[model samples]
Target chain A: MIENVCLGQYIPGSSILHRLDPRIKILSFVIFMIISFMSGNIFSMSILILSVAVIILLSGVPLKVYFQSTKYILFLIFLSCVFNVFYDYGEAVFKFWVLTVTLESIKNSVIIILRVTSLMFVSSSVMFTTSHSNISFAIETFMKPLSIFKINAQDIATMITISLKFVPIIFEETNKIINAQRSRGADLDNKNIIKKVKSYIPIIFPLFFLSFKRASDLAVAMESRCYNNIIKRTSIREFKISILDISCLIYIIVILIGVVYCEYLMI
Target chain B: MSALDIKNLSYIYNQGTDLEKIAVNNVNLSINDGEIIGIIGHTGSGKSTFAQMLSGTVKPTAGKIFLYGKDIWKDYKNRKEVYFKVGLVFQYPEKQLFAQTVYEDIAFGPKNQGFSEGETEEKVFEALDFVNIDKKLLNRSPFELSGGEKRRVAIAGIFAMNPGVLILDEPTSGLDPISREKIINNILSYHSKKRGAVIFISHFMEETARISDRVAIMDRGKIKMVDTPENVFYDYKSLKSINLDAPQITKIVSNIHSKGYNINKKIVTVEKGTQEILRLLRE
Candidate 1:
């Protein structure tokens, strides 16, 4: 429901981090996430968390505004922690009426929460600062290395970007349908689970129809613009790996290596 | 007493959120049985929000809506019953049709209201006939019909319920002239035959002036004027203030009146305008 509310949600800022090439930010983001997973103990998790915090600070976006994005997923994060705390079988540190909290369990819970939070915050920073069009271009460029594996990177990137684009469009269409149905006395909010599922038919029916129609229109528009599907489609300007981009990439690589070595020590 | 009465109704969107907006301010209106009212307002003037409140699609943020002198939100049971009594056809509702065949789609509302199999079929066919769609097209997939035909079928879906108050939002929008005439004529005919109250929102002033018993001018979430079509049109000053104008012929007739000639300022149609001008010129 929240996602259906508006478009052009990116917050604008003039920080140097906002000016960094989206391609480097994307690569560094992925590298950091992977390093977060590799991080085992509290110390290593702190390092990963610190990296995400630094990126968030550099983005110059209001910290509270950036964290508000995680509110929707807080339920899932809590569920994970609660499940881990109870189900993890280890040396008990505290016991209460047939329930036991163990040292290993608490540590595992903290690691997972920190890992997920770090991933969410870092990726959000990228989305907050980078425009969607630039992200699409960066994704297309980064996938070029996948050509060695005999994959069409452009096709993959285009598909990803198109799917991402449709998410918001579909959300908007669904909200309109919901409002329309409600105006007709279709009470969706005060219904049981089974009834709720049935109520979705009206909203879903129109949305499916509109999405196909939109896809067809988009295809025709793309063709009219002389879109060539094959043979290394040209860009008006090519991306050059600048000094800032290289330094950011190097720093991300060093962090990944350091985290892996720390995990080795923990084991 | 009015068949439907809204007293001091107000609504706010995203009420508790930082982005909260007052879509419909405190306003009161009423509709009696067998009255056809046209509500006209520009986009975001809260006309649509008002329509939603009337049909019980939304509970007002404040105030009470009465149907037959009883509060609509008195209880959950009464609220459910009120929906069938006040049918709402959204703009381009045709796209909401999803049944495999046209008949089932048209019968959706009546069936949802718990009509028996034979009765539902009878009502669905009656609605289709009322909307003037060809009987031959009843068995076809709704998706296969032309846009205007699909729109009619969608309307027939709501008509099958045979509600006491029918509300339509921009029913003739995006249709050819002939199709527009057909839909508007169908609505007028339905109103005459059923004798039910009808509230419709439209931007086409000429068409609305022709069919509506009364016109309600809304500006910035407030109903500026509610009068018979002639009276509403005659008030050109207020209409101009709201960036709306009377029908083209009405404006010409009013201009003639301004030139110290004897003419009815209430004249709306082009034919009446011509006759009145000729009569004045003869003198």
Candidate 2:
């Protein structure tokens, strides 16, 4: 059941998006996220959404996987849409008791849904195309300027890489603990809220203990290998921006311009 | 009726995905009450997956699992009852320990079984005794225990459930020889006392041959053979073809028999092998 979580999971492929440099992918993701949120009207939002769709197609990752990742946040999207529909700023198109549905409110909710979905699809696309180590490498390169301020970019990168690596491992450990408890008659599907919450005690406690134990073991292993965070480490694979990366960046820039023009038109 | 009957049992992992794998495939077996069945397989032979299905922790993709003539998956609402009837001690079960104290950890299963408070305590003590754990450590945190002790405590937690079919996956892996012997003895005593069907999954041929009434060999998600230990180990060549070895005693006796020494090749345990050799020397 935990296998359905696609967040931060990388799918290997030889697609155009996969070939792009990690730094370029990370930069594009941030830019896309910002522009998607800044989108004010349907035209601007549609432009961003169209670009995301194109990116997803180039990613070579199945559309079902992206949908699975967004499924986890569907409730949040629905909640925000409901709140937008009830906001008292617009002229009411219909009234049922205390609830008010307005023309502008409906339009705002549609924009909100589109904005959130496009943001999720863009992030998932980036994650699917870029490996975790590449992400850490990209982050380290990006954070290199902070080294002048006495911050260790390599250490931060290592921390991020380790945590990212543990996401799947922790999921596997939780699955094992859940099966063990279930074999011993844990009613994890109990209908009562209190009982259901209490049933997770077996799963949560063991998972936390196992994770801590694993972390300590990892520390000891690193110490034994003479790993010193103070020493500067060189990466084996150096990031080089290829023609594909530059073109992708140009494409994103064009999409940003189109979205800005649409926003201006809306104003 | 057989205590545990599996018919065409199958399990597929990640079905329909590119990573799809047939973990257990079209297997059939019947384990009688009060019987001990040993399952030996190489890593990824689907032994663990098959054990999980037998305990109803994992539902098979296609097939039926019957616990004493009742289909475990027939009634979804009462499927939880199968957990009480079939207890599974996972590989390296020590990681399953969670409660604050050893007592509480063992009691968790019986309590979940809806046993009364007094019955839960009694069952916990009985489980501790079955696993040969010290009662003085009842109040101590399970995390503070040694590796072997933690493993024992974890097994005791499952034992407290008093399941009719106990499935243990590699229970003695990574343990000292003495602890391994103690665990085997505890399992034997538990089976004798409870008269429940025991399915022991392991990579160790000697221990499996020593305790099992019948041994089942699995290769690539299929059960290659199931027979008495003596008969199973007697055919060492077939076992070797599947990347498995008979117990050392069986191999030695078979080697002696091949040398025209008139020794019995079906010897599986060390004691029986010794007895056969001694008789030959007397002759």
Candidate 3:
């Protein structure tokens, strides 16, 4: 039941993006995020947008999916735009009863909207292109230095992996609970906001209880399987940054330098 | 007249998308009053989906369903009335019990249907009595009960509504043999007393054969065959081909028959097989 949620759904492909080691893909995504946020001028921001388009093409994931992912956050985008338009102090270009809109404010609002959109797409692409297992392995490798600080990095990584795994499980449990309630004449949908919030009691309480029960069962199952907290946990496939990775890293670094210098000139 | 009649029923989940799945396909089926029918299929064979459609929990994407010659989905507004008339007991339904007392949980359905306070109280006890859940445990929280008891309470919750057609999806799953037998026997007793039509969806072939008056074998969102248990079990070859199998005793008895030990092909119960085998040995 929980499997129905298609957020960050991966599209399998035989393209070069699909063949890249997941760790390299993850590190590159982080660099992409830095470039996206640091883009100051429209020129560099347009380059960032172009890079997203290129990556989407290379990943072989459809553009429709990118729009679908953005659909979930459309409310926030709209809210930000509305808030920036009337509230920001600037020379007025248009006037209503109490609303004053300006070109500068509009430009600022568009920049924020673009930045947010870029952030959403960048993170989602990482999720859509790479498998969760590889991301977990990457996280473990990335946190290797934390062991020196007397923290159990392996445990943290395993926890993150299991939590990611249970996101679907929780959703499934929620669906079951909702269906059970619906069968009892509980109308969750097509109800007013007040009624909807009240309807959530039936869904939420059962889900919360089941989640705890599942966690207990999982803990017992884990103990039965002899799970350990060993830091040097090995995997079947090891991640190694190759020449291809270095070249890609250098290319992104050059783009970042050029974009930042261009933004400086714009200012 | 048949208690429930489903004609050309079809249902699809997430239609018009890549994830579209045909859960139930054009299925025509009927259930007479006081009859106990078993629906057996592998997981995702559309047994549960069919049961859900019959229980009015799922609206068929196509076709018509008549309960007592009246269209069940006549109007969208009175859909809740349909739900009340045809009760559904989902798999692991016990997890839905959240009331402070088992009595309250059982009465919740009846109360929702607009039954009076006194009538609701009596119906709650009646449901408790029907399921054989002791009256002493009625005031206690359902969380304190064992898994089997909780399942019974959940079933009782639906039973309080006294639906004319009862649909249970995999009711015996994930339980001890003794609990499973008790639950099945309780359902049988309920059917006998109430004279209501029952559709028990299960994967346990042996129990289904023992209890069912008619068996519907489903495979890949379609009913492969529907007939009396003896008739359906006779075509063991085709049954297996569609990911279904006959009861083990039927196979053994058929093997015995092939050995010139004259035994009836219609034998369903182990006791009957034993009697036939002894009769053959004596002859």
On DockQ, the leading prediction is 2
**Retained native contacts per candidate, as fractions?**
0.35, 0.76, 0.30
Candidate 2 residues A56-171, lDDT tens each?
Answer: 99999878888886786977898879988988767889998898889999988888888888888889888888899999999998999998999998889989999988987898
Query: Can you list each candidate's DockQ?
Result: 0.35, 0.63, 0.35
DockQ of 3: 0.35
Candidate 2 deviant stretches above 4 angstroms: A1-3, A265-267
Deviation of model 1 at A115, angstroms: 1.9
Model 1, residue A191: distance off in Å is 7.7
Give the clash count for each candidate. Answer: 0, 0, 1
lDDT per residue (tens digit) for residues B96-138 in model 3 = 8878788878977887788899999999988877788899998
lDDT of 3 by residue, A1-267 (tens): 112435665556577676777778778878887887888677898887777776777776666677776676966797978788886477889899888899888888888888788777767777777777777888887888997899886788778877877876677677777777777766677558997897677678767778888889989999898887853667988767777667667766777877788787656
Write down the lDDT of every candidate, Cα atoms only.
0.81, 0.90, 0.81
| Number of the top-ranking candidate, with lDDT as the measure | 2
Candidate 1 stretches greater than 4 Å from native: A1-20, A47-73, A93-101, A147-155, A179-199, A230-267, B13-21, B73-79, B235-241, B281-283
Docking class of 2: medium
Off by over 4 Å in 3: A1-3, A8-13, A190-195, A243-251, B12-21, B59-61, B69-74, B274-283
Give me the candidate number with maximum TM-score: 2
How many residue pairs of model 2 clash at the backbone? 0
